[model samples]
Target chain A: MSAVIEIEGLRKTFRSVRHGKRVAVDGFDLLVEAGQIHGFLGPNGSGKTTTLRALLGLVRADGGRMTVLGEPSPELLPRVAGRVGAIVESPQFFGNFTGRRTLRLLARAGGVSISRVDEALELVGLRDRGDDRVKGYSLGMKQRLAVASALLKDPRLLILDEPANGLDPAGIREMRDLMRSLAAAGVTVLVSSHILGEIQLICDHVTIISRGRRVAAGRVDEVLAGHDRHEFLVRVAEPERAVDLLHEAELTAAVEGTALVVSGVTDPTVISRVLGEQGLWVGELTPLRPDLESVFLELTGAGEHPSVPRQVDDSALPAGADDAAVIDLDVRGVDA
Target chain B: MNLVRAELERLSARRFVQLMVVLLALAFAVTAATTLAGSHRPSEAELSSARTQAAEALQGMEATHQQCLARQNSMTPPGETDDFYATDCSEFDPIRQDRLPIAADYLPGVFSFEQQARPLLYFLIAFLVLFGFLVGASYIGADLNSGGVVNLLLWRPRRLTVLGTKLGTLLGTVLALAVGASLVYLATFWVIGQTAGLGGRPGDDFWRSLGAIHGRGLVLVLLATALGFAIATLGRHTSAALGAAAAYTVVWELGARLVLEIVDARRPDRLMLSSHIAAWLNGKVRFWDNQLCTSSSGTDPCSGFYSLTWGPSLVVLLVITGGLTVAAFAVFRRRDLL
Candidate 1:
């Protein structure tokens, strides 16, 4: 697939009265392949939105090589823009207009057929209430209408900033499915979201940004599996004593609550046998492979789940059992 | 289906414009009706009252004439044409003279809605002609200041085209609205004039009078609209531009007239909106009173040229609007919408 979006050495700064000068985006580079769901993840004000705006030609960059669908962003913005759709931040719709009418207006502006308006509404699951005035609609409904408007043109590339901002669980899932379907139809989808778990589940590729610069980017698995380490969390009856026993065995282990996480081991069977021989009854030993959630926190020190506290804050607590990743744990520990 | 429809649709997007149209229409209708009904020539009963006064004046003069005759026959030297026609009767009689042009001269003609309600001239000029530009300013300025315009600018990506389209649409709407409003006002005024007075036979200059008012109103509307549009674009908001235009047009004109009254200078240039429009309709070019407007009166801010060559006035007006438009677009092209 061709790279639908390509950026190199992008830099953007704002002349501010209060702050003197603020660089919103700096040296940001990214390539989004056609037909792939590329995740643009960043904290608020990290310049993710700024980069998107630059791509749309809303803001001129200070210095950068950027192209959309292989066309230079500035010179070819008009030609390439019709084939791309976006919702920069908050969804804007005429308050008096109906959801259906707003989409129809957008379709007209985008030079698409009127039928596309209905298609967009149906795709966003807003068809039943399409005639409702936007003012009466909920925030989630407004967001859906925005997506519907963006999809009306059947764009080849879709840039959405927090597309799922007001969506409920079902709505988010539906949006994920719709995005996947769009990607399957060969449309490049670049979405920015703060929800890491959702990104892990929905995106095919992820790019993590920090303070207006990229720090990590790659396929979901390639990025999540950091530095070639496989770790597993070992659950047993005596969590503290079990961890101490592993420490006595001359093996380095991290304890996260009741789970004794052992890393660097080649096999879980060895840990099970060693514990069994030592007169220690093991309840369960499960391998914890890297996922997007843990990797995201490890990289940015931020994660969606609140229960998963930072390891930095609770160093005394064991890291989830660091048992090395194994296909199967045939040596199941004794029943509790 | 056509561009006009699109223009109307775009205008429909704005709520204030709709309100303005409704208010102007009702106010114009009522004012026209009031003027036509109130100022119309008297009926036979009222004519009797006028006759009674004329008779009373004649009686007093007769008593004085008896005494003068007893004293001196001095009326002989006075021209015979100056002699008052002395008559006497008890019934009402029609007293007529050659028609005065003042009322019909300023009357809005042939337009049914503008009949008697000449206020349409000021009303339309105030809202329809000039306010459209002010409205356009807010449309673009609000969008630019807020986030919505930035979103569209990013997507469409051509600054010049965006600016040009906005300008063209705004100009088109202003002209169309001004013309439509003028037509309504003219029609009403003409109807009222025909019914109330205008009873004289069509004179040689009748067509000229009509042409003068029509031509002047149209030209003034066009110029005023362009001027206001440019100002709004410059101001970048609805209120500031509208307020400035209003102050310059209304307050400045009145103030200039007051100043000219004291200074003993003929202020051909210092015409505020209504007076300037009146002068222009008379085929004379006058400058606005203050430096606030586009044209400046050299040396003396108060002493501007009274009359402009018609050709130069037209050219200057166009150039000012065109130049300001170009400048506005240049700023629009590069400046960040956000």
Candidate 2:
């Protein structure tokens, strides 16, 4: 696939007389492929918005070779910006106007027809209440309205910073589906979110950053791979016999009160055959897969782990999903 | 057309603007009612009282001046005095050249409750302050704070037009208010002519003369409005912009004038826009018989009242307002509102 948004050797910093100076983005490189639902994931203030702003020419970059569509970011902003749409940070709006009126104004300014406003509003599920003043809108409704405004131009590349802000569970679900369909229709979406699990579910690729640098990038599964450590628990009525047989096969086994903790052996077949020939019946063989959270914590310097544990069910996905999911994404795969 | 309509809707929907519009209309109505309410019957008792006061005051002033002149003349040699000076005491005196504005003569005829609160012109100035706070904030400062301007900028993908349209909306609203105020002023005077006996008074003249007062009033309104808007754009903080405007008009302008007066320095009033417009509005004040004409300060840079005709001063005001507005738009278009 051709590249839609490209950044190479990008750098930026902020200087204020009162607060001193801070480096936001340091020599960052990113390439979002055409028609992919790309996820740019990072902890708060990790330069996601800064990079996106630089790409949109909303903020000047200290140094970079950045391009959107085809031309360089600075020289091609006007020419390429029409084909690109963005909703940076919070949804900006004129409080007095209705959702429909605001969308219509944006459409006219974008040189898009007024009819497109209705279509955009409907896509965002704001059709019913489009006539009400934006001031009366709930936070979620306002965010959706902003999404509608961004969609007015039918852009090929959509850059969104925390687009799902203020959305409830159901709204988030609908937004996820909408993003899928947009990508299917060949729209390139670059979404940034702190919610890593959501990115795993909806994005084709993800780039993770920490302290103004890329920590991990590529297909979600690949970023989680090698870190997907699993061990099988062997149980039998003759526990001592099983341990003796396992030890003879050069497996380091630890006693976890009742069950022996076998170190480094993942496949059930190898353990079953070696112990089965010794006339021992092993009752349980369980394989554990390390989740995205563990991998993320290990990769990024945000040392604290997420409190919620993941019940990873590899069986629910298709047979080849684990391997296929790992290799074929942008940003961080070894192949990439 | 759609964008322009949206701009109007957004401005009208603003809370501050809606409050201001309602308050402004009410303020105008209240002022008009009070100014036109008093009867011009000229009762016999009041007339008798005025005649007694004038006679007594004039007699007192005459006695004092006579005593002083007699003392001076007795000491003076006759050959030093010219026949002309004794014959015409008032001729070519610089004080005689200081003609008071005609607006002062009709000021008492204004007769509204607000008008009676003297220096109603200051209320008009205050309106500009409130108007600027509402309109300037909604257009740019609010947009930045909400990130609404960034969204609009993203959608349109043309920064310049968005900034231009924001300003265009402000200008359009100001013009509409001006025209409305003028119509109200005309209707007030018409009522006064038919009812308050202004026809017998000296101020009943060409409608154009009254219009010139409204015209100058309109300029004052736009200048304050535009200056506030420009400051708001630069500061990007509504409260800060308001503070800056207040500092310039109240602290800077008022302070300078006060210091100059204390020191008895030359040309203090020229630094003030209000004084210049005052000269322009003088002829139209219902209480003041005519515009004040002074030899000092208004027309010249150093003179506090160097005389500038209505047309020139108005043109100067427009240019200043226009220049500031354009500069404001330019800065706003380039900034990253986020």
Candidate 3:
């Protein structure tokens, strides 16, 4: 697939008399191919918005190169701007203008047919309230209007920063569906949001950024698979005995509440066979896979504490065997 | 062209511009009413009384002239002529009928379009200048402050083109409004004169002079509007333009005038912006300069006058407008819109 957007070694720094200098985006690199709904995930102040702004020419960049649809960004951005739609931040409109009037003005400015204004409004489910003044709309409705504006040109590439901001659960689902429909219609969407769950649900590809740099990026499942530990949750009537049996067989196991978590196991039959020989029949054995949230938190260091080191809990081990059967797995970070 | 059309539509839709238009209409109405109420056609009896009073005043003036001539001819010093010992007799010249004051002139008789409309035209021009400045400032100021400019840039990525189009639209609209408003103002006053006072036809020379003044007024309004837009664009907020205007007025107009007075500066009015504006509008204005004296005595203080003409005033205004506009455009082209 052809790359729709490419950013290489992009850097931007903001300087002021009071704040001195701040590196908002540092050597950040991103590549989005055509027909992919890419999710850009980051915490607050992680340079997600800065990268988007720099790419769109809203702000000048200090270093590196960026391109949109094979044209160098900010300079040649206008050439392809008609084919691309972007909303960098929460754009506020004239409060006195009706929603329809606002869209009509944007449509005229962009040289798009005015009929698309109604279509964009319908796509975002704002057609009914299109006549209402913008000041009277709720926050979610405003967000929807912003989305409607981005969809005015029926763009091939859509860049939205925090598109789900101020959206209710239902509205978020509607937005998700709208994105899915757009993607199905051959549009490449690059959506940045703090809502990792929504990103996991809708995006085919994901890029995770932290401290103004990309920490992880790939297909959602592939990124998750790199963090997967092949661990399993084992439940039995005698969890302590199961831990002892599993430890004797050279399997790392820790009793967590009512179940013992087994790690470093290549095959599931080994755990059942090792436990059944000693009359310890496992009631349940479920394989635990890593999700995007855990991997995102781990890669972004969101779960890291400054003053403390992560360690496996010795209290969860059997009483007398704690010294010899200590599992070296640092699961505290995952638990956090 | 499309962007220009959109901007014009947006400008017209602004509540502040709408309010300014309403105020302009109200001001025109008030001026017309005041002009109608202040003028009238004098009666024949009043004319007869004015003639009688002129005869009595002329008789008294002739008696004073005879006394001055006798004093000058008889009381001359040896070394000096009548110039030193007594007043010059030539101060009293051949009295003419026009020199005598008419009652209709003193009272609010017929309103002469040639004589009375210039000052009122100045008022109209002043109001329009103020209107243009404020509307131009808010036009771009509100957009930059509210991120509306950013929204427009997202649609049209050419920064210079967007800013240039906005400036062009502002200047064009101000010119159109000034022309339309001036026409209406002059027409309404003419109607008022015809209905309640004299509507004497003015000669071509008078209309030509008035037209020239109107042209200058239009230029001034355009310049003021551009200045406001440039300052607001540079500051990225409406309050910045307003603050700059207030600072100039208080510091330069009022404060510097006092400072210049204390220092006894020569041609102090030459250093003032208001004086330049007045000169530009009125062709030329004379200011009293007591320091520019050629001769003085013990009792009489030294005094003279200085005049500010149109050429220099136009240059100063153009330089300010051009400099700020260029700066605003350069900064806008490079600065990051946060």
Reference-based lDDT, each prediction:
0.65, 0.67, 0.84
- TM-score of each candidate structure, all chains considered together: 0.75, 0.76, 0.87
**DockQ score of candidate 1?**
0.18
lDDT of 3 by residue, A156-270 (tens): 9999989998999999999999999999999999999988899999999999876566778899999998998999999888999999998999999999999989998879999
Candidate 1 per-residue lDDT, tens place, B1-338, comes to 22234334545676666776677778777877776766564455655555566666556655555654533344434322223432111111222222322333343322232222334455555555445655665666555544545544534567776566666676777677767777777666666656774444445465456555556566665665556555655655556566886687566666766676677554535333444444555556545443343353333223333464445555555676678777777666665444
Error of 3 at B71 (Å): 11
- Candidates ranked by TM-score, best first? 3, 2, 1
Ranking by DockQ: 3, 2, 1
Count of backbone collisions within predicted model 1: 38
Q: Which parts of model 2 are misplaced by more than 4 Å?
A: A94-96, A226-268, A273-284, A304-336, B40-130, B200-209, B249-334
The best candidate by lDDT is 3
- Please write out the lDDT profile of model 1 over residues A1-336, one tens digit for every residue: 789999998887776454445656667789898888999986555577778878787677899899998899877878887788788777566677788876765555445788888888999999899999888988899899888877877899998889998899999999999999998998899999977778888899988765556768888878876644656678777777776777777666777876788878777777777677777777777777777656655555455456875332221101332222111110111110
DockQ of each: 0.18, 0.28, 0.37
Candidate 3: tens digits of C-alpha lDDT, residues B243-335: 999999999999999999899888899988889899999899889988786445433423376799999999988998899999999999987
iRMSD (Å) of candidate 1? 13.1
C-alpha positional error of residue A180 in candidate 3 after TM-score superposition, expressed in Å = 1.1
Model 3 chain A worst lDDT window (10 residues)? A327-336
lDDT of residue B325 for candidate 3: 96
Clashing pairs in 3: none
lDDT of 2 by residue, B143-196 (tens): 655666666666555666776777778778877875776466456655654565
Worst 10 residues of 3 chain B by lDDT: B78-87
Cα-lDDT of candidate 1: 0.65
- Residue B205, candidate 2: alpha-carbon lDDT: 45
